[model samples]
Target: MARNRYSFLVKLPTAIALIAAADQLFLGTAIGSWIGALALGWILALLLSRPALRRRPSLVALAVAAGFTGVLAHAPSLLGWVLFWSALSIAALMPRIGRFDDAWRWGLRLLAHAMTGPLAPLLDGIRLFRARPRRGRPSSSGLAALLVLPLAMTGLFLALFASANPLIARGLTQVSLPSSFSVIFWALVLLVVWPSLRPTRWATRIVARMPSADIELPGLPQATLLLSLILFNAVFALQNGLDLAFLWSGAALPEGVTLADYAHRGAYPLIATALLAGLFVLVALKPGSASAANPAIRRLVVLWVAQNLLLVASSILRTLDYVEAYSLTGFRIAALAWMGLVAIGLVLICWRMLAGRSAAWLINANALMAALALGAASVVDLDASAAAWNVRHAREVGGRGVELDLCYLSWTGPSSLLSLIELERRPLPPRFRDRVRYVRAEVLETLVRRQADWRSWTWRNQRRLDTARRLLGANPPAPAATWPGTHRECDGWIRDDPAPEPAPSVTSESDPVANAVATTTPPLTGTPSR
Candidate 1:
């Protein structure tokens, strides 16, 4: 695989080079500007090399990159950081090499390429400079000899002089390196050196040279594949049937089982099961395997995938029902999204098996889908969405869920203000209503104060703050503590009195459980960050 040297002229590296320069130079003036500065740099690089981009990515690909960058720029959360780098990676490569055809292999190749990308050019520059002839410049061999003896003698004399004249030495050594100069020097060096780390075939060749065990395992024996499929299908059938009966049909659960608890228990684990099933399919049903060629085995595999899809759907409904019973949350929302993705992946797997598509094709297709979803999410504020859903579906809003957890809303930060304001309009007990007003007012005031500071400005916060002010007006909000309780039931909803104490229990004197309970200290409590 002799790759072209001119590949360095592609837009991907150009975009990267520009980003490396900008991030190195302009990132630290305002710490908050880091994501925005980097995002702007990426978008600029893309736009700058638009004319030169040889293989224009599909609009979907571009959207994925944009969404990944947009959300990261807006939120700056941990997820955002991961997506930001991943987006940069896919974008930087896609336009030059085109879509990756081998999923597992290409992924390894891309990783190594990124590590080596920046280092290769620096070494090349050193080599090129070393080989260049200086026609008229002095050899420096004589210069080095002339300086060696004198430099050592000067250092010796300076050391003796410094010891003799302490004040003079202190004055001479007082001039130290400036902190700002150190920052600029490193940034400048990176900016100058980054353009040299051009992408090469080194990673690709190395990955190709690596051994594979594809031929070693005779793929799960056909008899084993069939038996495994039958057993898996039966097990999945039982779970899916139970879900359809008890959950979807609204039948009562066994004593001690809440629907929310049941849903929570199965949601993530079922997703894992589906993922494992997909993996099994990829490995056991290699493209032209005897099992894949058997129509009966293919049918069984298809049936199993269908069962997995049903399980995924049940998991989704279970999550939604749980959210309705409790309240919406970021984790629950993400879990739902992930479950949906797994469901889609299962469908893709079935298609791959039926249509004779390679695992690579399946991978590329899923990657494209993931990229798009992320990009679309980036355009909206997910926290605000969660806050609004939770507030609207809350018991205060005639939903069968818990009433607005004011403390929880506070943990949601200012994103819950509008929802809190809406809840305030509802006819709540005077105490609950007052708490809502108090909390929203407090959050808005905090936002206004923070926004007033030059250092704390962010587009998302600024936009939300402006909306918060417009909705709540300029009056300063009252302190949340003014509502009475130290603890809160919701972000804005507080209790006037402490929680009711548990009833005294009558237990056997010899009961070990009772003894343990008596000795055990209660665990600590506080609201989680939303």
Candidate 2:
């Protein structure tokens, strides 16, 4: 086996670091720290795969920009979490493969990159054995060195154990050294431990650069194309018609049907069906096929694709209606963006089939579209966005929405600081009011707590805390009041003194929204404020 010294240097640490970070038992599960570790591995992978980032402006920007987005994300959000891992893998592989831009194929190629590391250490062992002299017996001096070293270690350890020093005696007694003759342990280590220790070179310029020879694919038959399009259009029409009548026009569902049930059930599955339809269209109506050339079939394909687009529209409406009753979330935002991409992809598929674009063109176009979407998602702090939407649309607020989900809102962490502030200011009904107060207080204290260090600082967190602070400072929030029969766990509303009475009006920004505060009458006669 050919040895790559430089590659060995890069791969070993990278493999160890990645595997170690993923080993939750040892590292524990801290998302920020875990992602931070992966970020280092990403940089190593990029430098290993493409050393010439300076000369490659686009590559440099892609790497550096991705680094910022992943690292400085508002802690770890739903969108930020996915984008963070994906951006790392894509950054490592994009510069290597230019032929097929499919992410699925690239992911497979990345897995293949991982395989090369396994036998590397074994190769070194074999090479060393072969380089030795022709004698079957080992050299006297080398044999002595090996034997003497272990004996020396044993003597030193035994001396320390028997030493008068109490610290050394206790340290040696507490440590359990592995058995030297543990064949089972050695077997397990060789079979498992060794592979992960090795790292693979991202073989782009070598194996990846070689172009695969192409075979001429016969055009899809005329009959098959027409028949497939006819069948697909019929199927799509049925689905779309149902969606139009019930979803778009707000026709009643069968008895006992709620809007949320109707909307939630269809949102995800329809997107998947639309994606499959797009794939079928690509295959059945490949460019230059006899069916594609037929004007009548082309028209039918357009009609069918239009129906699929409508299906996408229905899915969006379904999700939006669902969100109105439910609250916004990271996955929900991603799902919305994903449905949009599917819609855009269907349009692109139509364009390709009509324009007779090459396969390469379709792949690259789709890849570019995906890259743009991911890049946009990376910078957006989804936790903050979701929190803001949920708080603004809460039933207590003026917007049409569900009762506040205080438990979930709390889990969103400091990104929801401003929204928690807004929730605190709103007058909630007695049942949810106390929970909201508790959640808001918990959220507020966490955000304003003493800094652990500069390492914990992030732009999203900083900006949000600043905004929450300014709002709190402008008007000291009312103390959390408890209704009769409500138990106080931690008494989060404890204050040094009562809030100051506000003057009639004060000079502030002219912005209506910024100056706005919801007026709420206290309905619950609670115990006097502390």
Candidate 3:
């Protein structure tokens, strides 16, 4: 009873502050600078509501930093929002995040918190109310009954008086009540912010009730494990040997099989294989298992893991070669990062086996690596980087790369605007240069319109616009009178005729240009950036 009362009282002020903050920052306003303030407020509210959090200033600072990173692009992204909020929630709920917590446990706790957080304040209030003693006084239900008649009679008399007097009726008519939407909006704000202000320990309690991870499962027979390791090693070695010849040694692939085919086909599948191998090791060679103890099996496991690392390296090389052949994009960059993580994970698995480290140690190490990657990703704009890379390596720019992929650049939105302007200034064939300018103009128009409203502004886009303006000068190229395709494919290629018609009906459905654009797989649509 005492604890419930204390908890409710302590959190009430913080909850009210958050409600006001949310009302000011989020209600009826576009998301921009408000994101950072709201993020910081959440962290601050957590600290004030939970006294223990105040002592961990470093952790709190980390949460603040992470939350702010989400707004670095001047607008919050899905990833940014996730990192910002998750960092605060994890910091508040998982007290030993850096030291003792693993990803699986952290994820479980977060899931629990999210599921129960919204109802926490209501449940706490109920408990507090129930805990109050009646002691010969009217209980809560009786008190409600006591007020019923006076409230009803006052309402009844007021209605009668309003019926008899025009002035009273007019006053009653002028009295405004909150709209249903307003009530719902406030309720939603309370539901969303109150949970973080008074985070429930129900998640921790649930996690505590989960079964221990130490429960032993039946392990693979030593002989079966040994045979599996040998066969796996042999198969992996064969693949690595082929990669050594075709990828590293520069031996040509068999006729009709281009290097691009080899590189593209192997990159993702190899990572999947490595992941499967990691899972197999976890299940088959857990610490204290017979196969993990056998000298021969240990040797085979190390060799297999080493081969997996080599496979990961091959996959990385494959992706790089593919990127070189095609063009870089955000997804490819993430894939490369994923391959690197897989390599590190394989190393950790080997280390765990060799050093006799616990599974928890390995899981924690990998989780730390993953968290750092996500944190770094939150702050860095990969699309911008990809745009810059493509512009630099573009064949039109005299680099030995593929032709400038204007379609992809357009899909990347304003992030590619400055890059497109740079490409426009580069020495290229006259027609292609015009195409580049057209794309740049469209992107610039979108950017200028977006920046015109301060609500949608971000420093990154503003800087890009400023830089592009400096480069393009007062008179920038205008958008083509017609779009390049039915959709703004921005490929800058249409019929080979002297002049392609207007965008709406320029090309018939059977036109080769239309086919080319339509055939471009994974058709991209949507405003490139917010």
Clashes counted in candidate 2 amount to: 0
- Output candidate 2 Cα RMSD: 15.4
CA-lDDT, candidates in order: 0.67, 0.65, 0.78
For each candidate in turn, the TM-score is 0.71, 0.68, 0.82
lDDT by residue (tens digit), candidate 3, 1-530: 66656777788877777777776666566666556666776676776677666656437645565555546446567777777767667666655333435566767888998899888868876776576545676544566678999999999999999999999999999999978876777778777677666667787888877765455778878889888998999999999999999998889899999877887788888999999999899777887666788999999998999899999999999988988988999989998898889999998988888788887788788988997888777778899899999989988778888977898988788888878877777778887876787778778888898788766677777888889889988987664555343433467654433566557855567698877776675656886876
Which stretches in model 2 have alpha-carbon errors above 4 Å?
1-105, 114-220, 251-264, 426-435, 448-457, 474-530
Q: How close is candidate 2 to the true structure, as a TM-score?
A: 0.68
Q: Residues 1-530, candidate 2: write the lDDT tens digits.
A: 22344444455555454444445322322344334544555455456544543245336545654665555444544556455545444454454443345544554554654454345466744544444444575643466667998999998878867696888878778988756544444443343333333323443434455443222456677777788788988988888888778888889989998766777898889888889988777767778767778998899889988998999999999999888878789789988999998999999999999999866677667878887887677667676788899888877777798866766777876767677777766776664555666776677777656233344445556677778778778655544675654444432433345455888665357655545542233455868787
Which pairs clash inside model 3?
none
Of candidates 3 and 2, the better by TM-score: 3
How close to the true structure is residue 517 of candidate 3, measured as C-alpha lDDT?
Answer: 71
Please report, as a residue range, the 10-residue window in candidate 2 with the lowest summed lDDT.
Answer: 24-33
Candidate 1 vs candidate 2: the TM-score winner is 1
Off by over 4 Å in 1: 1-34, 42-81, 90-103, 114-176, 180-204, 208-217, 254-261, 476-530
Using lDDT as the measure, what is the rank order of every candidate, best first?
A: 3, 1, 2
